[model samples]
Target chain A: MFESADLTILAGLLSRYLVVLQAQQALLNSCTHFYQLEPRLARWLLMTADRAYSADLYLPLILSVQQRTYNTADLYILRSLQVAGCSVHWQAANDKRKFF
Target chain B: MIKENFFEQNHLLREFPQDVQQRLFPLLELISLPLGKVLYESGDPSNFVYFPTDAIVSLLYVMESGASAQISMVGNDGVVGVSLFMGGESTTSRAVVQCAGSAYRLNGQRLKDEFNRHGMLLFLMLRYTQSLITQMAQTAVCNRHHSIDQQLCRWLLLSNDRMPGNDLHITQELIANMLGVRREGVTDAAGRLQRDGVIEYSRGKISILNRPQLEVLCCECYAVVRTETERLLPWVFQKGCTVKTTEASMSAAKAD
Candidate 1:
């Protein structure tokens, strides 16, 4: 019974590599479009994203994903370190899970 | 001369802290994943984990009657063997290469050793595992509730996003096998997509002419999977991964 969603998990991670990248580009394009069509809505989204605590890390990755020529090796190294820090944070979260 | 740094495009290797990645580079075996090649069949103990650079692999759930349906698709963004890490030691599904391209295969023992460290590599993999769980859950919902046309669209979008080009080299029979539907159903759904000008299908090659329309016509399953994947594992969110940088650092490993 461990078929526990095998294909979904693989595709989940795999397809998102494109989805997130393309979606970020698409969202940017839509934002630019919205800025022209509906400035308030565009501003709201920008503000909302800014409030997210981890947006600092995510926003640059999204921006870099958009840039056609930016070197990613450096970004990959930094992101790995940042993510590793989160895992120790994950261990803390796992410990907290015992409470519930 | 054997090429260098080809694995840099692979996200798993790229995401590894440089030193950890450097340690694994020499052991990597870059090989061609030809179309229709089975990476592993049910119950096979995984000997290697493949990081697809430009290929696509479909995991299919086979029935006792020999019928099967694709459970998931793995592209350059993912590795072929997850069971190796999940403590399963084996998988019951069949992994077949859908696209003809290349991948870097690392010995399973090496992956196990790295994973055991519980450091950055293990951390990243655990996060990846979360996204996979979301995807698996969504697939079940989509399979049960969505239309055949919608399924075809999702499957096409998945396969299309995996490889480098716009067109996919696939046949209706193969699509049927993956979707666990009849050949006639795939032909019919594909015909509708072609007629709507969303895709151009000719001689087993599908070229996506309009992705927006396909997305619009697709069910919510695709969107749900995409959003959750980004939310759970944002590290893989990047483009132009194949672009080469710092070949000097990469090539230094060759002498070792």
Candidate 2:
């Protein structure tokens, strides 16, 4: 096995392999799980989040979600953030609509 | 068959008690929304609440570099220009017509007047606003994690839901602009979808050939948006309407 390289080289190679494998596995898992659900609904969730203003910025929680492939738990947390954010919007809508 | 029709289509407004509907309905005026129209540019003072009847509007935020990505889409199912009524008096986002149709426009003063009344209408709009924010937040997540193809599928579905036609009249360039990606990415995604028989594109139009397959290829972001939108604003299903049957029907169709 190529595992017998100098210690530093071996560590670098292993880390690289791990990253590649992680990426591949993430894609495969997302594909499999999403394939199980209705396409429009699944697709909607992805695009919906992309449309957020802070989408370009990283949120600590969202970062944790991104560390893994798309998962139900990640989606749940995303929904919670959406709810909280929306509550703010809800307040604003009510506030703005209050003008006489 | 006037702007009131547009107001009635807004789930939040429709769910309001009759008294609330009466007060708000009188303030709404029918407005023609043409394709490519900008309701207001980013940072402009907000002045109206628009409820689209058939139109699809996109909320886009631009950077100093002039790059922009859509923050959300509003259709008959929702309202636009919440910032006007939300007390912000202005928004950093731009509202543009994603699909050409019509909308019911409520004057800002009148809308605020109604909001001040503080009843079901206020509660409904606020809840709906929460749903919108949820959409914005989730869009950020999806863009970071999902592929362009999955994002395209979700975009198409949302547009299709709002549009009266099956074919979407939009260019890849516009899509790239909305996704904040290069045009080449959209081209590649479109090519893949065409090859997969999931959609057909000619020039600026894209027609769905297999919605079910497209859904399978999409990520979980679509579901999150729908679920959040549903939970934050339960009225999306319509009064007395059951979503379970719709869900079953869709599943059965997909199975077939």
Best by the TM-score measure: 1
Checking candidate 1 for backbone clashes, the offending pairs are: A9-B132
Score candidate 2 by TM-score against the native.
0.65
State iRMS for model 2.
17.5
Native contacts present in each candidate (fraction) = 0.00, 0.00
DockQ of each: 0.02, 0.02
Clashes of each: 1, 30
Q: TM-score of the second chain in each model?
A: 0.89, 0.86
- lDDT, candidate 1, residue B7? 64
Backbone clash tally (model 1): 1
Candidate 1, residues B1-256, lDDT tens digits: the string is 2345566566667777777777787788767777899998877887888888777888776655687767677776677777665455667678898776677788887876776655687667766665655555555456655788998888877666555667787778898887677899999999999999999999878899998899999998888877776676554555545443234533443444
Off by more than 4 A, model 1: A1-100, B1-5, B242-256
